[model samples]
Target: MSAAGGGSAGSIRIDRLLVYLRFARTRSAALALIDTHALRRNRKHVLRASEQVRIGDVLTIALGSGVRVVELLALPPRRGSPAEAASHYREVDSDGLDRKGQMTIGASSPAPGILSGDPEDFS
Candidate 1:
C-alpha cells in the first residue's frame, strides 16, 4: 500500500516477501526464483508470484544445493538489514534433509555428535 511496505499484517505478495527477506537481490530475481517451481508453501507448489503469505505460514524454498524451511514470524515493513530480515521468520528443521539433502536424522546429526548445542556459544 504505502511506500514503506504493505499495509496491515494479513498477507504480503510472495515476490515482495522474497525481496523483503533478502532472498533475492531484487523483485525480478525473486520472480525468477518463483518461476523455478521449487518454492512450496505448506508443502504445496507455488504456482504464482502474487501468492499471499501470512504469519505462521511454512515455506520450503530450494536454494542452490539444499532446501530451507522457514516459518513466517512476521511480515517485514521494508528491506532492512540482514538481522532485521532474519527477525521476520524462523528457520525450522524440515523433514530431516541433511546438507546434501539426504535423510540422516535418525542415524546422526548433520556434523555428527555436534547437534542441539552450539560449541562456540559462550553466552
Candidate 2:
C-alpha cells in the first residue's frame, strides 16, 4: 500500500484503525455506519471495514444529524486508554460546526441533561 503524507513505515494497517475506532466507541457503530454508506476517507466514500488507514488522512463519519471529520495524526500498534487513544488523531479544521450554523453532533456538549430531579430520589 502507498503511504502518503510522510507516514512512518509501520503506521499503515487495518488493526491500527480498529484500535482508534474502538477507542472512539465507534468500532461497531462505524462498521454499521460504513455499511450504510455513512463513512468516508479523504472525502471518498469507504465501504470496507478492514481498509488500512494512515496518518494525516481525513475520516468523515456520518452521525445522527451531522458528520464528524477526524484527521489522523498517529497510528499506534495497540489500543490504549482513552487519554492515549485521543493522541492518535487530531480534529481537522473543517470538522467543526454544520452548514446550518449549529454545533456538529460530536462536538462537546455542556453537561448532559438538566439538574431538575430531586436529590432524595437517589438511594
Candidate 3:
C-alpha cells in the first residue's frame, strides 16, 4: 500500500500531475514542457513525461519567465479547482529570505536557449 492509503499507490504520471496541479494547461502542453528538459524532480532533470511523481516529491519547473519550485503535499485524485490543486503542493520560495533573514539562492531567471512561450518554437 502506498502512502495515499489505497492499493493504487501515491503516485501520478508527471504529465498528468502537471495538468492536475494547474501547472500545464493540458497534457500536450505538459509534454511540450517536458520536451524542453527543464522540469526537475528532486533536483534531477526529468527526461520523460511517463516519469512518476509521488507525494512529497519536489518539482522544479522552468516557466516562460521564471522557475518555480514546489513540494508535493498530496496526490490529487483529479484535476480539481485551482484552490484544491494548490493544496496538493507547497511552493518552495527559494528567492525569498529564509527564516534566518538571509537571501537564499534560487533560479530567478528564465532558462537560457529555452523558448518557453513561443508556440511556434514547439512545432
Candidate 4:
C-alpha cells in the first residue's frame, strides 16, 4: 500500500501524491515529470520524486506549455472518482497563492486553454 502523508506532519511524497491525485496516469509518469526538473514546490524547483509535500505546500508541474499549480491537501485513501480526487486540493496561481480558489484544478479542462470555474472530469 502507498503511504499517506507519511513524512513531516502528514506529508505525502511528490510522485505518490501525483498518482493519488490522478495528475499522472501512473507513478512512473509522475517520476518522469520530476526527472525533467520541471516540477516546483512553492515556486522553487523540485529535485526529486521522493520529495515530501505538506498540506499547504504549493506545487507547480509543467504540462505542455502551461503549468499546473496544486496545493497539497489531505492524504487520500484511494484514486476515487475524478470529483473525489479534486477535493483533495485547490489550484494555486503564479503569485504563489490561490485567488479564493478561482483557478481550475483537474486533469482536464472543459475548454482548450481557459479553465472553467468548477473543475470537471472530461474523461
Best by lDDT: 3
Per-residue C-alpha lDDT of model 3 across residues 1-123, encoded as one tens digit per residue: 554333457777888888777777777878877776758887777788888888878888877767777999998888787778889999888664134632222333333433343445333
Model 3 residue 24 CA deviation (Å) reads 0.5
* Model 2 misplaced regions, further than 4 Å: 1-28, 95-123
Write model 1 residue lDDT over 10-122, tens digit each, in one string: 78888888878766667776676666665778767778888888888877776554566889998787888777888999888855433553332122122211112232311
Clashing pairs in 1: none
TM-score of each model, in listed order: 0.70, 0.57, 0.71, 0.69
Worst 10 residues of 3 by lDDT: 102-111
lDDT per model vs. reference: 0.66, 0.52, 0.71, 0.66
Q: Kindly provide the TM-score of model 4 when superposed on the true structure, using C-alpha atoms.
A: 0.69
Pairs in steric clash, model 3: none
Per-residue CA lDDT of model 4 for 82-116, tens digit only, reads: 77888998876668555573444323322232222
Q: List ranges where model 3 is wrong by over 4 Å.
A: 1-8, 95-123
Clashes of 2: 0
Candidate 4 — worst ten consecutive residues by lDDT sum?
A: 108-117
TM-score comparison, 3 vs 4, better candidate? 3
Q: Which stretches of candidate 4 lie over 4 Å from their true place?
A: 1-9, 94-122
